[model samples]
Target chain A: MSGSDASATTLGEASERETLKRIFPRLPESRSTIVGPGDDAAVLAAPDGRYVVTTDMMVHGPDFRWAWSAPYDLGWKAAATNLSDVAAMGAVPTALVVAIAAPASTPVSDLEELADGLRDGCAALAPGCGVVGGDLSVSDTFTIAVTAFGDLEGRAPVLRSGARVGDVVAVSGMLGAAATGLRLLFSEAVDAAGEPDRARFERVLAAHPETVTAQLRPRPPIADGPLAAQAGATAMLDLSDGLALDARRVAEASGVGIDLDPGLLGDDVEIALTGGEDHGLFAAFPAGAGLPGGFRAIGVVVPGAGVLVGGRPFDERGGWDPYIGWDGHGG
Target chain B: MSGSDASATTLGEASERETLKRIFPRLPESRSTIVGPGDDAAVLAAPDGRYVVTTDMMVHGPDFRWAWSAPYDLGWKAAATNLSDVAAMGAVPTALVVAIAAPASTPVSDLEELADGLRDGCAALAPGCGVVGGDLSVSDTFTIAVTAFGDLEGRAPVLRSGARVGDVVAVSGMLGAAATGLRLLFSEAVDAAGEPDRARFERVLAAHPETVTAQLRPRPPIADGPLAAQAGATAMLDLSDGLALDARRVAEASGVGIDLDPGLLGDDVEIALTGGEDHGLFAAFPAGAGLPGGFRAIGVVVPGAGVLVGGRPFDERGGWDPYIGWDGHGG
Candidate 1:
């Protein structure tokens, strides 16, 4: 079936072309999208002679709960997580291509709203970015898998293994904000709401919404990444799986140790150390270099073989393992 | 848990790092992977100053059947589908990034086998291409979403919207093989096998394996796409959704109509016109432009609205409609 073949009453079973017409105009148009959605593939400008590519997928039941998140929030989070990886690479995200798997029973309006959120997320957070292409399919479960391509603007990518000993460690944005938001969403006050969904969602948002928003719609320090890279940061990565675990990753990759000072993170010290999904940029730079405005010192890179918090060994690896349920079901 | 923090007893519940360690070696490495899997994002060389990117996903039930397709075939098909899109755009595939979501209960060996399949697929089908990066997540249903990045080598993309009315329509490979393969897989003889799965698969393979292979792991005319583009093809697309329907797409996009000659399709005229998943390169060239070696004229672009079969308007829309189900399960 074609786009023009659909009638007003036949919107529920609209052809893929028809559905795409509704989505195309809503997506932001960016200069990087040399060939946008509608073709077999999209041609995007690489600009600096290289492409920084990353992908992340969110599945229903595990990645989001419809009882809490709207379709729009899911779309925003999907774009946010992938874009943050590009940012962590010290590149400016240019375009996104999403492949969505859904059951045919899904409402057309829901998909449209999701596309709107995808466009809005890029515009409000990573300006000059847009969704370039997409593919749709029917499946038993709902899933949104997004791939983002970025341009480095002629600068070299900041890899996690580039850290050197004596480099001052810094993070752009709050650590563990998403972990705090997840905990809040599961609290008795939020889970025990007896009202209908709309009223409950509004009420939930009315209470400590900023933290909840961090979990549902993360606005990572995207622009700050390139600025830090330009300012001579040697190594970088996004705090997707908490500072402790991810910091250990960089330390291991760079063949060094890290001395983490949780106290420097203020009141959310523990969360800052162990919380995942923060999407903050963690980097290492020469000790005396001027820091980007969004960054604050978290610790220093050391010449050793382990991660030390407050100069002492830390045991808790409380970061999320996607395969393991909170109740230890799958694990 | 960190990469070195896992023990023999805890392998089943091993941390993400350990699981990734097993996956990393299984993925094929390429020179284009400036920064590979262990980084925040993979950096691939885009020497042409631009990149051609496309994505596709395969689900457990809808896209493949575990009983019919081995892990290797699934990997091959996933890679083939996305790479074909790059080929359709007249580009050489440089790298692939795969995101796999599967239940934690899945065996470690199975994941390794899947990764091996992915590597083998790249080595055998798309030489010089490799899996550069990936993300692993947990989900009840298994899904593999792959993104392929390509280098245009400074050539203009062959778009579906560029076909001219007088262009000759051509195809680079067989049509309807996958559709026929699907029919055979559903046959009673294959369904009634009492032998072990390995023996049964061999027996099935002994009976016209090429057709089944077409459905499971299509070897699309990848190199021929660029060849046709270089040979002055006016428009191009991969024969993914079938000839008649996809031809209609090109005609619609270019404001022309396609006149298909079913008799010229050799033996499987019906399949040639309607079979989905052929993955052949379909192109339109100037009336007398020298055709690529692999291409043969199958029709002609006409000056009209809808697709015509042998000079008559054809009503059957046999292309795959993703929203509709084979057994009416979803729509």
Candidate 2:
């Protein structure tokens, strides 16, 4: 990301109070927020008797590189991913508490843009949800940990362990674009020595805006999550660790099996099946109950174990595990 | 701080799934948990219409060092600090979503102990409050970000902006011990070259268990928060920053000044006034209202704009701001 603002000052040059003054105004407040930032704790309304909560962390090197993502993209992606988890539980997002740690040398403008992205992301994906509280600190590596809260709105949470045999499995949102964009960034946006090059990344992003944007700032089908639940989704989860792996999770949790039709997946079925970071909703519904408007049927629950594609067992690792997959390289 | 488990394995040597399997059992569950870990999001009961929420982060170098703190201490401190924020709001802590990122070389056993600490801390400080969800990731530095949720139980939130000039200032839990412990750790528990020494840390800890333990694992009077609120506290805040700074915060927020009696502060009044990380409850109550059992009078709200000690303006730079205070040395 370019830090070209003439007034840019690194966090190290400013006190925490000064840095907060610069960024706080850009943050959005939710209707549910009774008390917003600047307090010891924020008070949020949860009209229902219950709330849904989840947390996710994105680390600098293992999650994204500055060479490939801007501060805005980082903030938006962080919000999107965690909001998806809340939505996956068939809840409407209400508030977020974000904690960020970055190197002292990071430019203050970058943090402002990050706050803007967090504001805009909540505005776009979950209209009534916004940042309620946050903490900022210094670290050698930049990291964001967002804890998202959602209101159940008097509805039962959709769980992955509710799928039953003879149910139809459907998915909402794009499947393989993010993973494909990641592949492209890794393969084409690097210099001769394999270090990510910002200039080349811009070119690649321009060449594949749809895919690259999906990877950088995903627009998951946030509304469709509650829609699926209202339509009586028996089992549901957000597609994060690839279709095959996530589908298998539902299968194992529900004590059933999933058999997907490859033909239902768009071209490059392999990528759609085993690629990750889709942030889409994958759900199961009663066979006759019709899929939600944004959902497309891709499989069916069967009385067996594991996942299958075209009636055959499908297992191709199916996802990325940072602990085992990271190659110890930022790029 | 010892990684003495013979069966210890580095995060990089195990898959995320295997590591979670070891940790899930150690995490505590709250009675309000409708759905705990293993789901897209945990569903927690928020019986009241509103919930108090807060987040805090601890970074490896700036917030802690392995040479001085164990994984257990890190986890305990992380939970204690965040939980204190919830309590400060006059709410009962209900759940926490913790996200952690550590070096690939960190031992799995250390993480297990960290989990135990999280479980035990919640069990000890705020009974029935427990870890409901969390995220694990890889980073060059060990970082922990915890977001705590609390139920107000129908009481109006006691805000920092609610104090009046005639209110009496009171406090629960010890002040300055944690900061004093930090000073001792830095000065006495370091090698000749100024790097933290594990042996020296152990020796210093043995020599001054009260202060050292206070720094590593604070036991803030969590219950006294709601007790003070029920006793008609007009305002309250947790003392994370020093007494003077935090008192100034409450004073500015409430448009009043705080006059503290130095005689009430124990010996070493300077440290008691300026040292940070106390995590005690500082509150304001009506002048004639009886103080809660655990709380004792320390000051009075005055008709001014800052903090006063012994009836005079107190302006020593009280408190630590990581951005300015961190000297780029882990020790």
Best by DockQ: 2
User: Which portions of model 1 miss their true places by more than 4 Å?
Assistant: A1-12, A189-204, A326-331, B1-12, B187-205, B326-331
The parts of candidate 2 lying over 4 Å away from their true place are A1-6, A329-331, B1-6, B329-331
DockQ, per-model, please?
A: 0.59, 0.87
Candidate 2 global CA lDDT score: 0.91
TM-score attained by chain A of model 2: 0.97
Candidate 1, residue A159: the lDDT equals 91
What's the TM-score of every candidate structure? 0.92, 0.98
Alpha carbon lDDT at B202, candidate 1: 60
Q: Which pairs of residues collide in model 2?
A: none
**lDDT tens readout by residue for model 2, B1-331:** 3445534788888789988999889987887898999999999887887888999999988898899999998889999998899999999899888899988988898999999899989999999999998999999889999999898889999999999988999989988999999999999999999899999999999999999999999998899888888999999999999999999999999999999999999998998899899999999999999999689999999998899998999988789888985667465
Q: What is the TM-score of chain A alone in each candidate?
A: 0.91, 0.97
On lDDT, the leading prediction is 2
Distance from true location, Cα of B311 in model 2, Å: 1.3
